[model samples]
Target: MGLLSNRQRSNLIKSYLYILPAFLFLLIFTYYPIFYAIFISFFRWSTDYPQKVFAGVQNYVEILKGDLFWKVAWNTLLYSVSTIFISMALGLFLAVQINKKVRASGVFKVALFYPMMIPLAAAALIWLWIYIPTYGLLDHLLSGLGLPTLPWLNSTETALWCIVAVGVWKHVGYYMILFLAGLYNVPSELLDAATVEGAGGFHRFWRITFPLLSSYTFFVFIINIVDSLQSIDLVYIMTQGRPADATNLMVYYIYQQAFRYWNMGVGSTLTSMLTIFLLICVAVIFSTIGRRIYYEV
Candidate 1:
C-alpha cells in the first residue's frame, strides 16, 4: 500500500472502472440466471403450487427416473456424436481439397461458406421443405431414380437422423473455414522438407500436416460438441420433438419443461444436469485429447 504513488493508483482505478461494465453484464445476464436456476431446482414451483415448496433433490430424482428424459438423453447423444464426427470429417476433407489451390478456389470457398450465412431457423425451414413427402425435393429425386421414398421427418427411425443431417449441413461450412485457417498456419517449411525426403502426399499429411493441426482439431471438437449439445433452433422449427420424441434434445427438453409445461423446478434441474454434463465433457477432453495438442513456439 505504501509503495503505490497517486498516479499509479489513478491508472489502476481507471482500469478497474473500464472492466466493471463487462463484469456487471456477465453477472446480471449469465451468472445470476445460472445460480438462480440451480437454486430453483431445489424447490417445487409450478402452476399447481400456490407457493414455492422446498423439495430437495426430488426434482432431480423424478427427472432421472422418467423414461422420456432417458429417451431425450439418448436422442441428444446420437445427435451430438453424429453431427460432431461427420461435420469435422467433411469439413477437414473439404478444407484440405480447397487448400490445394484448386481451380476457382475463391468461388468454391464462397459456395462452401454460403450455408453459414443463413440463420439456423431459416436453414431448418428450408430443409423442412426439402423433406416434405412426395412433393419434396428429396422424394422427387428418389422417385426419379425408381427408388422408394422414406418419410424423412415423420418416421421415428429417421426423424432424428434427418435433423442430424440438417445440423451437419448447416455447420460443416463453419468448421471448414476454421480448418482452412489452421491449414494456412501449418509451416510450409516442414512440408517442403518432407517432400525433399521423398515423402508422398499421404505420408506428408499423416506425419506432418495432421499432427500440426491437432490444436485446431481439438478446438473444433470442443466447439462442435457444445454446439451439437445446445442446438435447438432446428428441432424447434422443423420437428418440435415430434415422431415420438425421437428428435427431442437436452436443451429443447429443458425449454419445454421451463416454458411450455410450466414446470420450472424440473426445468431448472434439467438445466443444472446439462451444465454438469457439459463440464464433465470439457474436463475429460482437456484431460485426455487436449494433452496432445502441439503448440508452435
Candidate 2:
C-alpha cells in the first residue's frame, strides 16, 4: 500500500513537470503582458514618470478624439479588405491551375510558394526598389515601353494600393497551399456527376468545386483579415507610413504611439481597441458567414 501511494505521487509529480515549461512560457509571454497592458491602459504610464497616475478613461477618450487614430483605423480596414479579397481570388485561381495534372506541376507549385518563404522585410525592400521613381526595374521597363512611369510609393493616392499589391504578391502563395489542400480533397465523383448532368466547365465549378471549397475559403478569409490588420513590417520597411500617412495601419500607428512617442497610456488603449475590434469581427463572421463553410469528414 505504501509503495503504491508513493508511485502514484511520483506519477503526478512527473505529469506536472512535463507541463511546467509550457505553463511558464504562457505566464511570462501571454498572460503577464495581457494583464500588464490592461493595467497600464487606465493610467498615464511612461518611462519618464517614476509613478504612474490613474487617468481613468482619459486615454481612451483622447485616442477616440485623435484624427490620426481614425485615419489609421480607416487605412487598416481598407488594407485588410483589399488584401484579403485579392489574395483569396489569386490564391484560388493559382490553386485550381496548379491542381491540374499539368506538365511540371511540382515545379510550378514550388515556384508559386517561393514568395511566401521570403522574409517580409527583405520582400518589402525588394519591392521598394521596384517602385522607385527612376532607375528602378519597373519604372525603367515602363519608360522603355514608351509608357509614362507613375509614382508608386511617392503619391498618397497610389501608396496604399501599391503596398496592398506587394502584400498580395507576398502572401498569395501561402494561401494557395491552403486552397490546393482543399481542392485535392474534393471528391472526383462530384465532378463526374456534374459532367454527366451536362454541366459546362464554369457551371460545374460554380455548382460543385466552389461549394466544396467553402471551408477553405472561409479559413483563408479569416487568416487574411487578421494578417492584414496586423501588418506592419512591410509597410514600415517600404513606406514608413509616408506620403501623408497613406499606409499608416493600426498596428503601425500603435507601435509609433507606444514606443516612439512614449505614449504608453494611449498605446494600451489602442491595443485594447484593436483587440475588441478583432473579437467583434471574428464573432460576426462566425455567427453569419461561417455557417456557409462546409466541413468534410
Candidate 3:
C-alpha cells in the first residue's frame, strides 16, 4: 500500500510539472497583460511621466468626448456586421457546393482555401496593387470592357466596402471549411426523409441542413465578428485608414493612439472598452443564440 501510494504521488507530481509551463505562459502573457491594461486605464502615464498617476475616469471621459471615437465605433459595427453576413452566406454556399461529390472537388477545395494560407500582409499588398486607381488590373479590365474605372480604395464612399471585400475574400474559405465539416457530419437519413416528403432543395436546406448546422453557423458568426473587430493588418497595409479616416477601425485606431500618438493612458482605456464590448458580445451570443444552436449526436 505504501509503494502504491508513493507511485501515485510521483505520477501526480509529474502531471503538474508538465502543466506548469503552460499555466505560467498563460499567466504571464494573457492574464498579466489584461490586468496591466486595466490598471493602466485608470492612470495618466507617458514616457515623459513614467510613473502612473491615477486620473480616475478622465481617460474614459476623454475617449467618450472624442468625435473619432464614435466614428470608429460606427465603422467597426458596419465592418463587423457586413463581414459576418457576407462571409457566412458565401461560406454556406461554398460548403454546400463542395459537399456535393462533384468532379474535381479536391482541386476546388484547395483553390478556395489558398487565400487563407497566404500571410495577411502579403494578401493586402496584392489587393493594394489590384485596387490602384489608374494603373491597376481592375482599371485596365474595366477600360477594356468599356466600364468606368473605380476608385476602390481612394474614395470615402467605396473604401470601407473595398476593405470588406478583401476581408471576405480572405476569410470565406476558412468558414467554408467549418461549414463543410458540419455538413459532412449531418445524417443523410434526415436529408433523405425530407426529400421523400417532397420537400424541395431550398426547403430541405432551410428546414433540415440549416438547423443541423446551427452550431457551426453560430461559431462562425462569433469568430468572424471578433476577427472583423480586430481587423488591422489588411487595412493598415492597404488603406491605412485613408480618405479622411474613412476606413479607420477600432484596432487600427487603438494602435495609432497607443503607438503613434504615445497616449498610453487613453489607449489603455480604449483597450479596456474593446475588451468589455467583446465580452458582452460573446456573452450575448452564447446566452441567446447559443441556446438555439443544435448539436447532433
Which candidate number would show the highest TM-score if scored against the true structure? 1
lDDT of 1 by residue, 36-61 (tens): 99999999988986488999999999
**Candidate 3 whole-model C-alpha lDDT, 0 to 1:** 0.91
User: lDDT per residue, candidate 2, 66-107, as tens digits?
Assistant: 898889889998999999999999999999999888899999
Tens digit of per-residue lDDT, candidate 3, span 1-297: 466688798998899999999999999998898889989999998776578889999999989998999999999899989999999999999999999899999998999999999998999989999999978988879988998999989999999999999999999999999999999988999899989999999998999899989988988988887899999987788877888889999999989989988889988999999998999989998999898778763
Candidate lDDT scores, in order, read: 0.92, 0.89, 0.91
What are the per-model numbers of colliding residue pairs? 0, 0, 0
Q: Which of the numbered candidates is closest to the native, going by highest lDDT?
A: 1
Best-to-worst order by lDDT is: 1, 3, 2
Looking at candidate 2, what is the lDDT of residue 94?
Answer: 92
Candidate 2 structure lDDT: 0.89
Q: Which regions in candidate 2 have their CA more than 4 angstroms from the true location? A: 1-24, 47-50
For the record, the alpha-carbon RMSD of candidate 2 to the native fold, in angstroms, is 3.4
| Per-candidate TM-score against the hidden true structure | 0.96, 0.90, 0.93
